[model samples]
Target: MGKKKSKPAPLPQSLALPYTGVESHAHLDLPPFSSDIEEVLKRAKESGVRYICNVFLGHEAWKNNRHLFEQHDEVFFILGTHPSHVDQCTDAELGAMRAAFAEDSRLRGIGEIGLDYYWDHFPRENQKDIFIKQLHLAKELNTRVIIHSRDAAEDTIDVLETEGFVDYPVLWHCFGGDAELAERIVKNGWYLSIPGTVTYPKNEEAREALKVIPLDRMLIETDCPYLTPVPYRGKRNEPAYTVFTAECVAKELGIDTEELWTTCGNNAIRFFGL
Candidate 1:
């Protein structure tokens, strides 16, 4: 008879941290969580995640699916056109987002916006143009700005600098670079949203980079339905997994896990104004 295959470990529930951790970024409105969002939110709350910032990739996504979290007050919103989808952006869509923000008290930020060179799915110039437009919108509305930069760090920073975003309330989301990059981001007076990718075994640079990131300047996230942390790395990610990322980050920084968790959580809450 063939031997039985081992089952994956169950979701973590014993981190013992207080209900103070915030999932700084996530995409719970995506299809992966469509069937189990209620359970996912419950698990997240049980894992001590106080709030979750659910990112809507663009105006249509926000318009169509913003109702998913209506019953869950702990979930907030960040709306913007992602780099890959910049081709779909139009003036009317931008205007709609502005109107929604004015009408929705839960709309806390304008983001998941920036350059994405990895896919090259859209024209880089167009991406930069839409990115600047959104940045200006964030400024006009005076809301938090969350950035999604991948393989386009230099241009991202350059555009932000040129747009007078230096020393502004910007968050470099899903940071996957070295300590040097971490230093540069914080040096520009911006925050870094560390995702579950940091928990991977081979990402030594990220682990080492955590040493230089100040406690108050970093936040944790699942970026889910993607970047699930180790032990749960191959599984579909959810907001409940933020604690595992926090655990890994705390160990690298040589601090108490609970302390690091709470500090990062507080940093997220204050930064996103949740």
Candidate 2:
């Protein structure tokens, strides 16, 4: 496909600059964050962030949020069988995800679910099976997948294509891979979401990969309250802080910050159906 020109759409003054409508991709269920969540969410919305794609790390995390999805217009959740949690679960448990998804239209997609061979917590076969099952769930639900792939690009891509996502939306959240693989994902029409990782000056590979990702297919995230970008690098990350990631991406793309912010905001909205 040809590269599309990065023409920015005009945004309202209130929604302008620094940025609004940022997306945070990660485990939002951690206990430390639960206490100040109302204040945290208020700040996020005030910052112009439209929504969060909170991924539950396991089935246990999934049970607490039946009302959380409905609590905020800007907070959305993804129900999936995480690769890390596969060892603790069974096929029956994974199957229940489909049932839960079927009952709740609020579920925008399936994922933070994919292969992660970097850790040996789950068996290779079990991870593969759960990944494929979740992909199948996405197909059945006619929604996209917020994928998580670490050191398993080939295996992840292989399963995605084989399971049949020729036209489905797949997002590689917190993407930290090479340019070649970045090109491959873009070529296949999958979207890539970057987090604060891009802000680190030492992360040249992520910077290079940013060059290959089309602005239309790129999304910004905090992946927090971890992977906080500079300034907040050592602090807890939240949705409001995702603007730093957009700033980093804008710098790399050689474009104005506001322009890049608008582009990423639109991409996140379109990708997550927010």
Best by lDDT: 1
Tens digit of per-residue lDDT, candidate 2, span 1-274 = 9999865422222334653455748566787587887778777776667777787765567777555556776777787766877765566776777677777666788878898899857888889987887777678778888888888999999988888875578888888888999998998899998888887989999999989888888888887888888756787888777766776788888998778877888887887777
Instruction: Locate the minimum summed-lDDT window of 10 residues in model 1.
Output: 8-17
Give the per-residue lDDT of model 1 (tens digit) for 75-139: 99999989998987799889999998999889889988999999989889999999999999999
Q: Each model's TM-score, in the order given?
A: 0.97, 0.88
Quote the positional error of residue 71 for candidate 1 in Å.
1.0
Error of 2 at 213 (Å): 0.8
Provide the overall lDDT of each model, using Cα atoms, as 2-decimal numbers: 0.91, 0.77
Which candidate ranks first by TM-score, i.e. highest?
1
Clash statistics: count for each candidate: 0, 4
